[model samples]
Target: MTVVGKFLPLLGWVLAGVLMAEPASCESWVDLNVGSELQRPNEQTVVDQTALVRLNTRYSAPVGITLNAHYGLAHRVRLVDEPGTGIAAAQSTGADLRLWDLPTELWRSDGDTWVIEQNLDTLHGVFYWGAQEFTVGRQPISLGVSRQFSPLDVVVPQRIGAQERSYRPGVDAVRWRNPLGLTGELDVGWVFGQDNLLFARATQQWGTVSAEFTALTLNQAQWIVGLSTQTFAGDWGLWQESAWLHDDVLSGARITLGADRSVWSDVYVVAEYHYNDVGDAENMTSDFFQKGLVTLGKQHYVALNASATPSPLVNLNLGLLHNIQDADTLLLGNVGRSLGNNTQVDATIEVPLAKQDSGTEFAQIPLRLAVLWSTVF
Candidate 1:
């Protein structure tokens, strides 16, 4: 269907949700963002501009029902023949898991410069009883504990290089949560549509230490067993998460060890090491040519991120990713200033310290700069 045709049904749903609840009991939000990115991997430079609009509506009552929905529209214009892997799809495991083949791309300009896409990112109903909560419909399901790399976030793994990491795209799923007293909880989720998946996790805390155990199955295919823990030692925060993945093609473990600390007020740093044994890096840049690749090329890697708020309204951050096996590295830096009024602006740059034509992992990533402006009301 046309983009407009597909979006019509979503608009109706959003309106119906708002109208279903008393005006006083309804809550709604809208977010608008405009982002521009420049890539200069080689002599041929490219510029891409994207504008996104999101609408979120929720209705809750003490006795009746609760409904929530989210919708988004994005318009993008970029130079033709440029190389890029869609960042949105990269951040979403559900990009490959939806049962319906409904593509979000609405339309494209004749000259290949413009693409319009819209998605019903969230449409879920919530039920609450005492300390138990259940959510059904398409919703966001994020798992795991690691920051840069997540071994247990099988449902929607965050991309390591995503510029905007505030939101996770929703997948068709059902989730249940129950508190096991004040220090622990049991969480479960099931996803369907493209492929199916089921997982359950139990989390408990003791003193300043916390731990989790998870078991997950990929419908008819793979199984994952995971364990993770985090604790504080005096002034430092430490964490480790590891998972064993088993499938027809591969069986191995992915592990991550991380630490974070604040040296002083307004300054923080994080370091992590990731060891991926189950992924194949044979074709290192497969996604560079084709999109939607689910593989880890280099096995051993390290990531570091540090940020400092110099003033009440200004911030600076730096990050690094190094491939231990290949000696490839990527350096990242960004600056941001709060504009007040629930709005912000940020500029970021990434420099890959390897040759773009090399077989090494980070080397093939191009130099990129991006600026983003966003507001919520």
Candidate 2:
């Protein structure tokens, strides 16, 4: 049996115990999401279409405990208009799969063109007491100050140009957080398994500025230290994060600086710059996908994002990413509207700009259009 199958019965027993033992109030909710995407490559003769459905549930008890879980189903179809235009692509684009690393294939056929996958995105428990909190099981952990690019967020880092509706994958860990004072706190966590991934962070706030320092140990041999800070300058917000890794194999520093400002009441713009000393500028595509040393593979990058809400129920977003060394660019846009109190619809497009050669980074990505619908009950 699969890991999820073995754990389901145990989870059911625990939920029953919680419901029977607690005399306090209990709350539950469910969410349903459906998404479709189409891709057209520049020189390819085939078009690809993908469909996905996901269900998520959450339960909270008055005893200061909560449970959450998610399940997903997806299908992909390829149309071959020309025989020579069909090419296989990579299964995943990013490399942040440290936690909950399970095999995703439930069933596959037709030369792997048709596939079925099941994922358990989140399955965690939380307990609270006074100013202290404890959490265990599979959960998401993110650390950093920058919004677009975070150099300090090494664990389960965000992927660039991925679908916005997809949730961050959870990792199995035990974590603790405690309040130091009115404006200070401390967080500590240890990810399970053989890698010995342990981390601690301290944060403090003063007036309109906040700062954090973190230390991480990997496999009991390598260490990484990070610092991040955020502050307001007049009407604009500014932040920076930096991290240095000490390891025998690869040792370097990564830094990110970002700023954002509101243009009007409903519009805002953001810009960010990132630098990674461990990245390669000459062979970006191979370095990023094969070696997994850096997220972008380029030593220097610049990113810009803007969002506007013309009405209460509609929003528009635009994003641009440029590789300074390779001169490749990625452009993204999205439009979303609220259908009612419980439903929303969104449309998005992604286009990559690069040379025709396969060696270029962005050129390998096909032009993509996606639509998503979600409802909550």
In lDDT terms, which candidate is top? 1
| lDDT, candidate 2, 1-377, per-residue tens | 65544875897798679867876554555666666666767665455556566666666778788767666666555644455443353254433434445567666655555556666667777878877998877788787777767776656567776646235667777899999799999999987642446899999999998999999865655667999999989989999999886665567788999999999788999999999786765544442223232566667889999999999999999999887888889898999999999899999998988755757666677787878888887
TM-score to native of every candidate shown? 0.86, 0.85
lDDT score for candidate 1 against the true structure: 0.77
lDDT by candidate, in order shown: 0.77, 0.73
True-vs-predicted CA distance for residue 181, candidate 1, Å:
2.3
Q: How many residue pairs clash in each candidate?
A: 5, 0
Candidate 2 local Cα displacement, residue 65, angstroms: 1.9
RMSD of every candidate to native, in Å, equals 5.2, 4.0
